[model samples]
Target chain A: MAVSSTALVDEVVADVVDRVRGTLEDVFAAVAQVAERTTAIAAVRAAGRAPTTADLAALRPLLHERLRRRHDLISGIGFIAEPGLLGDVPAWLEWWQNHGEDGLRPLLPDLDPGTSAYSDYTHWDWFALPRATGERAVAGPYVDYLCSDEYSLTLSVPVQHGGRFLGVAAADVYLRHFEAAVLPLLRRLPAPAALVNARGRVAASTDPRHLAGSLLRSVSGRSCGPIPLTLVTALPAPRP
Target chain B: MSKLSNGALHAVFAPVGNLARVDAVVRRLADAIELGLLADGEQLPGESELATRLGVSTVTLREALMALRQQGLVTTRRGRGGGSFVTAPDQPRTARLGHRLADWSTEELRDLADHWAGVAGTAARLAAHRTEPEDLVPLQRSLEEFEAARDPAARGRVYGRLHVELAAAAQSARLTKEEIRIQAEIGALICLALGEDDARAAVVELHRALLRAVRDGDAELARSLAERRVQDAMERLIGLRLTVAG
Candidate 1:
């Protein structure tokens, strides 16, 4: 029984790793494509020259094509270049949700300060991690108030050419879907199993007793790159 | 009513009990085949012993076997060392299957997808949490079988078998039972439209990814992929229905 139980965990790990890899690769590719295409333009060359509304307007359709390819998994996609380009305010930020009758439609207010949707996103992990590391990064499984107050993970890739950082391209996926997919498997296990993130917070678990965000004892887990989520299993009682 | 004796009344009504006995026997054997629990070409025990095991009379068991034979799910041979044997499951004909499905509205298809998604998704998630490496042997074997099957019927059986394997890995008997029932109900219709090479290839890719997810213990990914697969099958059938109607 124990041997069979371990095999079940192994299968789940294999699937999660593939999905994470695929999703991250797609996000990175979309970022690279946008960076490659946008950089070719002479007008948007410096830190001060972030793409204008007209520039983003022209580029939306292209990014929409990429978004449609993974419509089943993704909720929204966004790009935020260095904030100084338009003025002192955080400008050059554009995000689109998979809404509207046809395809991806632009999210309103564009992070404007006075709007209720305003956020100091410069410090948020999704934007901050890629900027700090200058490599692909993932953030959240947190409440994304800006994107619908749904629990979501944001995968971001830094757009850089010749050591000059232009911005970051990112996508959002609701965690509910992940839970929808994963919780049942956990629930079926005879022993309790907890899915823990890098910070050691339980993301999901078979033990109905273990709530999300609670810290779980580190036992066994499988990591996917930097995410480092572990599947910790509860040990059995001592046999006399 | 008062004039009738109990024994005489039982004699008058025993056929109802016999009918039920035959039905029970038939369902037990048929469900086992549909769920892939009983392998094709497997031999049954001699009639007397089999009937005893099933706690049914020989006549009733024979009636049930005849029903199975008529449905082309079983074959009987007469000679030395001969007994009842299961026939390989056949793929449902498109026209006949489409007619049977005509009563299923788009809403019903969606509901089936929803039901399948819930069962499979949860089974995968649980399997990820509970499965050990050794438990993956059956799942991997199913994957290999699916890849090697060149014929549509073989591919279809393997495809449906994958879910049952996952449910077993989950170590949940209830989920496994539900998976078996769902497969028996819808596996034929799903396989009917997957005869096209391109469509089958796409499904194969999805299964490969799903297997990888399970192997990696990524419960979230495995669950999502399982749900998506059912949803895709339902959508494909709905589209086929639309085209046939038009």
Candidate 2:
């Protein structure tokens, strides 16, 4: 009976674990799209090709008129919380906040530090959470991208330029949307699956609490405490 | 980052006349519906420009217009100069899930029924297995209510609450939330079917089976029985054969 119960649990777990991978894939795809667009926009402006007033006309395919309009209308748009306070802040911070406020806010509201993410933690270091596999020394997932609020599954990526990390440009995608959007796309077999972050919090799952407080003490071949991850091998490694 | 001609590249904001630019747009559009600041067919600005003027974006403005559209106050025309215009609002779509019903397939109906039976059955089984004896009265009340309600919407609500109460009785919030979302989705699907009352009967029987299995502390039997209830339900949805014909 125990073995049968284990098998049934395995079937359900496999279904949920696939969702985690799906969530991660969708998130990564969205981020990659932003990254590509960012590089292109930067290149177009930096090419030093002076534009006639005609160049500003909405006829160019290279320019997203809506984005250009937004860049014009919305000052300092990128990956920050209070873009309104961008008055004296550095241009980098302004750029970060513009995208962060508009793009990340609706999708991942909990990650807004200015709103609710770090509202409880005053002056606490953002990168203090046990590192998953991404940034090594950055001080934040700055989950507090809002006005220092507590964020849900927020991640910070330090924008690197000329070897000095020019402040982090962050993007926080909601885990719930990740689960909804991409989880349905994952192919599942009879085995159970899981998405264990560096700290072992089960972000979202079919079996919500089955892995709560189930920490990964080491990424070195961790087993889910006797519930051998039968299909963990199929999941993608986190991007380096 | 690219260097730009500082002043030439300045952000151009369409000035807001007041606090409620987007609201003003809608109200103007609505009032114009009768007064002709808009005619029955005149076009308006695209969402982005309007949102920018209103200090909003296309999406936020759309969300507001969507509400008006829901209220049967406006519609959008396509093609050049196409934008939101006043319309005679139709009856708003209810939470009935009935509007999404026309494309509803028997397969979808059966899948929904089976999912509810299985999830709720497991929940019921768990409740019986774990609920304090004192908890039985509410279950009894819920059970009574499930049968007493007759209107499809009202019965659907009772059906959902029955499963919710059962899951809460099982003592796991994780389980209860999952069941709640499942129930909501199922509610939408259930509304599409003509035999929702019959589905209620299926839930009641499974509720009983779950109660018995849980009373026995038979987790294995409980889970499998829950699964069986789902199978029984799946059989009822049109267009599926249980056993393959040779």
Query: Judged by DockQ, which candidate is best?
Result: 2
Residue B154's C-alpha lDDT in candidate 1? 57
User: Among all windows of ten consecutive residues in candidate 2 chain B, which has the lowest summed lDDT?
Assistant: B1-10
What local lDDT score does residue B63 receive in model 1, on the 0 to 100 scale?
Answer: 97
Q: Highest TM-score among the candidates is held by which one?
A: 1
Residue-wise C-alpha lDDT for candidate 2, range B158-178, written one tens digit per residue: 555555656655544556655
Per-prediction TM-score to the true structure, in the order listed: 0.42, 0.32
Error of 2 at B185 (Å): 1.7
Q: What lDDT, from 0 to 1, does candidate 1 have?
A: 0.63
lDDT digits (tens) for residues B1-246 of candidate 1: 111111111111223224377765665565445433344786766788667666788888899899888767789889997899877557555554565456457886788789999999998887666554544665676777677777655566667767776775664556765676676556656776676777777777887788778778798999999888778777888888776652
lDDT (10s digit) by residue, model 2, range A67-114:
244332221123321222122321212222224334422112222222
Candidate 1 clashes: the total is 35
